[model samples]
Target: MQIVKYLKQYRIPFSGLAAGKHNFEFEIDDKFFDCYEHSLIKKGQLKADVEMQKQENMLIVNFHITGVIQLTCDVCLSEFESPLDFHERALVKFTDEDWNQDTEEVLVLSKTDYELDIAGLLYEYANVRVPYYSKCAEQGMNQSCDPEMLAKLSSEAADAEEDNTEEQIDPRWDILKNIKNN
Candidate 1:
């Protein structure tokens, strides 16, 4: 995967680490988002702190993300920076040929596997923190949305709602409705 090359630093080779809790830190930049073609975040700066707990049979990874990400406003298509802060945890268990991840937070890996590549996990955490609808603040110090675009979008939405309220029927469908009425 293209991500593997850029995020090679995120790979945690636990087979050699002594049984204990270990901490690793990394700084994520815009280049990290380039790995995914359809990523919502094309540019960002973030910090990640990963805490790995090694046990006899399983590994527990705790992730903390904090920083800012560049996003395009859905309302005006203007770029803005949004703060990102979240925590996520994952459980990795070792097994042989029985990789079952029906549990959302748990991952199954081969018993012989020596490392865990956490690039995907970090990406997911960052993506999850993004709001479904990102818009520049209507009233804020950093409000930078285009007024014309916002007005256009509002007018379009109002027009759409008006159209929905007054449903149009095709002539063929009208005949069917009349037959049912009779």
Candidate 2:
């Protein structure tokens, strides 16, 4: 059985349970990331805990995602690990008619089957927990960033801005050299 299928078994009974709070937990690791193709993550240690309260025809799922998501640095595009820490909530309602919704947090279920599989829900919440952009702290800024690359960029910009007099200009920029000093 697939890891996600674990939720399918509890569908009917859990849905019919009296209005109360229920809890579920999941562990995320490198193996989970490998399942996805071209995953940006190389390694991960995430924990997802969901608390749900059943009320009449609706279920409120509170997803708490926290841990470390091993991903490359966005700035330097180098392998780096960013911490994951966030919380999100969602509501699932059972309706007779399929209502088109405009949000990720609201879900409608069929009249026949009121049960919902939280695997997809967990995946989405985990994704949302990750910060869209994480910058390297000053201490770690240059750690992943290639020193040579930064040096090259610095030198190029410096050379462009310098007061390149005709005497200082390289032969290659003869036109530019004459425009300034001559």
Candidate 3:
């Protein structure tokens, strides 16, 4: 697991600082995922970065990330890469005293005291950035899609759909089939 040594150095320098903005970056790799037992997200590399503005007592954070997760298709259940990208921001306030955090977006830390553990923040940012509905592209949508797989999947789906409609009104459907009789 690669820790952000740069940010840790910033914490040491925070003692010498007035208020200012800072930037941080990270390159996520397979070893990073292995640390969390997150084997499900394998094969794809990710990049994450953040900008934090420190103004007197308030901290405004902006995050940007991009990556891909190898996922199984919903229809054919075949493995495919799903691309992801994300952006978000949050406000943090330094308080003279500790206060219970009500929302995940906001953080309030004791002013007389310490620093933020951006490890968790970075992890959360990457996870939340991914879309919930990510799926493999359709037959012609993705040009390189396997032809044999697409044909089998399309035929199976069409068969199921036909069966469903047929089961819904097979008897009355026969009546409609003779529409020209009477």
Candidate 4:
């Protein structure tokens, strides 16, 4: 895919790594998110630190993610930057036969494979950590939302609630209500 070119740097060649820990660092910017056609992250600046521990049979990779991303607030429709920090670990093993993994944190690759493509894992891990309802940072602290939009939305919601409070009885349900009263 065309996106592969942008993520090529995230590949780690594990065949030559010594049986020890190796560290790699990456800076994720706006261009990184451009690789994905549909993504909630419109703009971002993030730092990724990967620690790879290689053993004779298995590999352990730990990712530390920290940064800020610009997101559209669901409540106010305003864009704001939110801080991010998360840690993810993956266990990878060499396999002789092709198989699908049922585990979320484990991966199996062919013995002949030279490098591991970590871009997909990093992308998933990062996205899953984002809050579903993004709101302005100030709103979370009880400061304020977008004044004009908030006021309009508040008025509409109040009207809807008031309308719902005056309930109309269906003819079928009215008979049941009379029976209950009797």
Best by lDDT: 1
lDDT tens per residue, model 4, 1-182: 76788899989998888899999998887888888777667688889999999988788999999988877788888777778888999999988887787389899888898898888887777778678887785423343468999899999999988776655534666677899988
What is each predicted model's overall lDDT from 0 to 1?
0.84, 0.66, 0.64, 0.82
TM-score of each: 0.76, 0.66, 0.63, 0.80
RMSD after CA superposition, every candidate = 5.2, 5.6, 7.2, 4.8
Q: What ordering of candidates by TM-score runs from best to worst?
A: 4, 1, 2, 3
11-123: candidate 2 lDDT, tens digit per residue: 33454667899887777777666555555555888888878888888888887887877655555555656677778888878888757873777887766774666656655
Model 1 C-alpha lDDT per residue in residues 14-85, reported as the tens digit of each score? 999999899999888888888877777788899999999999889999998989898888769988888887
Model 3 lDDT per residue over 7-83, tens place: 34223223344577787777776555545545455545677677777778777878787776566655555677666
Runs of candidate 4 with Cα error greater than 4 angstroms are 138-143, 156-182
Better of 1 and 3 by lDDT: 1
Off by over 4 Å in 1: 1-3, 138-144, 148-182
Rank list by lDDT: 1, 4, 2, 3
Backbone clashes in model 4, listed as residue pairs: none
What is candidate 4's CA lDDT for residue 140? 38
RMSD in Å for candidate 1, one decimal? 5.2
